[model samples]
Structures are given as C-alpha cells and as structure tokens.
Target: MTATLDHQPIHSWLTDMDGVLVHEEAALPGAAEFIAALQQYGRPFLVLTNNSIFTPRDLRARLSRSGIDIPEESIWTSALATARFLAEQKPGAAAYVIGEAGLTSAMHEEGFILADSDVEFVVLGETRTYSFEAITRAIRLITGGAKFIATNPDVSGPSAEGPLPATGAVAAMITAATGIRPYYVGKPNPLMMRTALNRIGAHSETSIMIGDRMDTDVKSGLEAGMRSVLVLTGSTQEHELTKYPYRPTAVLDGIADVVPLVEQLTPHESVELDED
Candidate 1:
C-alpha cells in the first residue's frame, strides 16, 4: 500500500472533488474510505474543485449530505484561488465581480471592492444564472481597459441534466467582444495546485494529485512537480489517454483504489493548515 513517486514517499494529497470523489451528489466507490484513511493517518490533504459556484462551507454541507465528511477548511475552490491570486497581485483593489456567493465572498474577504464604475479588474466566476445584462456589462468594463480575470477555464460544467455553459464559455464571449483574453487562476495554471500546497505547508516533491481529468488536474500536478494519478470515475476515459501527449504518473479505476495508498504515505512531523 506504500505509494511513492520517483522513489519519494507521498506525505500529502491534492484531489479533485467532483469526478474523482463524487458524481451528481453521489459518493464514488471508495471515496469515503480514501478520506477516512487520510484522516486516520493524519496526512495533510485538500479537496480541490474548479467549480466556483459555492463556498467551501456550502460544498462541505453538500458533501456531508452525501455522507462524505470533508471539513470546510479542507475544501479549496477556484474562487478561493482567484481571491488569493488577486490579493497578492493587488491588495484592496476594486473589481466588477460577476458570480455567486463563493466568488463574491472570497473577494470581500480579501478586501476587494465590488463595484461597476472605474474598476481595476472584471472578475468572472461560475454561476447557474448567467445574466445577459451582467455579461454585457462585463464586456463593456473590459473594453474600457479593466483587466479581465476568470476563476477557471472550464468551458462547460456537468449537471444532472447535461452540460451547462461555464466560466470559460462566458470568458470566450467577453474575449470576442473586447479582444482580450482573461487570466485564469484555477487548474491547468498550476497556481491553484501551488496555492493548495502552500495552504497545507506541503511540498510538491512529497505530494500527490488525484483527479479525473488529464487536461487540468493531471497537467497542473505534473507542472507543479507532484505525482499525478488519473481516475476513470470522471470525464477522461481510458481510451482518451492516447489523445494527450503527456500521461499521469499513475492511472486507476477510481478513488477507491487510492484508499490503500493513503495508509502508505510517509509520516510527517506535523500537519499544518493555513488559517489566513
């Protein structure tokens, strides 16, 4: 059950939330066991998601309803990463924010002012209600020379019915009108992974990233110098592996398979959690 990458034992974990652990409000096979194992072993870990619609507290409640007991502090969303990035880039900056509570809450916590006129940035995040008036306003603001920032680059998000237009899709529309591309702060940028690592005080050399997507999760983990594992419980299929030039460090059937690996992680002196 000892999981090692490049002969180094893994002491920390970064896992994608939806596909690898749950699907449509249902916990995937062995997900609970994987989390339980991590908790039992005192391994530092974080549940990552590109979805910016809900806050960590909201996500924790949702997961708890599904019988997964993830702590609110253990959940990391694209909204939080975006907020952290912006806080470092420009403290107390004014922004024209377009998103839900998750995005807005993070911005407010970082001391960002959400306004319409004379903003320094136009921040975009995922929301079920994509208002035409809001999108138009975002386009106008960006056209007026405000820097564009998006939570994630996911073009579409999965729902009970089917795929829904997400941040990337809206960002594309804004880009088309303003001739400016948005700075995405979520997965595939590696900034998200790095930030999560920093939050847990974990190093990339001894951490593992588990995700269901090859494009975002695996790619970001690989770039961040962590071991990447692709689980087939989500979007990317086994056959689709041939399409990507880069491969994950390991491929498994689902998060259930990762439970045993958690028990095998090398022991660390202390578990650190970033409160700020």
Candidate 2:
C-alpha cells in the first residue's frame, strides 16, 4: 500500500520496535524497507522500546535474525532513559538494580554504582522472572530510604500464550508494599521521548513518532510535541482510538506504508548491510 503520510515531510523519525516493526520475533512486512528508506534518505531516526531485558547489542542481534537491520546506536530503550534520569538526578549515585543487563549496563555507563546496600535508588525493570525474593528485597530497600524508579508503566506485555506481567506490574507490587510510587522513565512520560530525540540531535518540531500503542508511544509523542502515528500492528486496535482524549497525527496500516513517504521526504542515498 502507498504511504498515507503527510506532505510535511518529517525530518526526523522516532518509532517503536516490537509492535510497529516486528511482532514477537518476526519482522512485520516492509519493516526492513522502512529502515533502509530512513538510512538511504539520511533522515535521522531511532527505534524505541520499553523492554529492559535485552541490551541494544542483544536486541540488534535479535532483530538481525528477524530481517530487521537496526544498528545498536539507532535503538533506544527504557533502560537508557532510566539510567540517564538517575545520572542527571544524582551523578554517580548507587542503585540496587532489579533488572537485567539492559538496565544495569546503562547505569554502569553513566558511572553509577550497583550495590545491594546503601543504594540511593531501587531501579526496577523487566526480567525473565520476577522472583518473590527480589521483590521483597526491593521493598526493604525502598522502605530503608532508597528511591523507587521503574523503566515503564506497562503492566503486562504480549506473550505467546497471552500477556505476561511486565515492569509496571512488578512496580505495583512494590508500591503496595512501600507506599512509594516509582518514577517511571519510559514512554507515556515524555522524558523518554525527549531523551531519544536528544540522543539523535533531533528536535520535536521536526520529528515524528510512530508506534503501535496509543497509550504509550502515541501519547508520549503527543506530549513531547512531536507528530504521532499509530500503526495498527500491535497492542492498540483501530477501534480503540476514540477511547483516548488525544489522537495521533496519522494512522497507517503498518510500517510498509511508511517507506514511500520516507523516500518522498528525503534525498536518496545508498544504504547497505555490513559484511560482518
């Protein structure tokens, strides 16, 4: 299908990864072409995700296996946002991280220390398993004066069988225990969107955000003052648009429709895969 994109020709693009470009482990139709189009046109773009389990390198490899060619630097995560937020709040502060490499490595990059005791933040994020033991420890830390922070507000995420408990779900449990709500650093909290834009040196006025979920991706983009697009390939359905007070700038079938618009918006240059 041809692109339904506007004539405004957004100079910068920010798009979500899992549902917008791929579903589960499979790349959606035209996802690769859309990435290639962005690169070929030399328009700055970043693939955004709230999943804190996998690092960028790990996610890049996973996408490569699915026929998507997003470079490590071109991807942004909630982990990165949380880390940056923590660093800005208190440079070199310690944290009791309850997450995987994506969340922990980002803290390390910002020169933050990871410890089980005397930490300033209880960094909560997604993991393969949310053990009861870990939750108890996090609760104790928060109660003992450690601040609460979470990657995203997603209560659950897509799974093969159904939705699985995500970061927000775990965060809720901790909140129930400590009565301290976490400062969520990911989408729906425009800080994450702005951080991604800053990472690519893009401005909100000239950039556009695309994603499958209106609650997070579209809402965050709107809150960030960027144009938003809701692709009906993920969590949000077409009929659900009216349920929200705000609306996206455009709604397309999927990323397949975005390539033509990218080609029309910028000058074409050749983009190729690396011979690793």
* Residue range 17-93, candidate 1, lDDT tens digits: 99988999999989889999999989999999999999999999999888899999999999999999999999999
Global lDDT of model 2? 0.88
Off by over 4 Å in 2: 1-9, 267-276
Q: Model 1: C-alpha RMSD to truth?
A: 5.1
lDDT of each: 0.90, 0.88
Q: What is the clash count for each candidate, in the order shown? A: 0, 0
lDDT by residue for model 2 over 1-276, one digit each (tens)? 222334344789999998889888999999999999989879899999999988999999999999989899999999999999889999999899999999989999999999989999999999978899989999999999999999999998878999899999999999998899999999999999999999999889778898999999999999999988788898899889889998887778888876766776543232221111
The collision pairs in model 1 are none
Q: What lDDT is reached at residue 22 by model 2?
A: 89
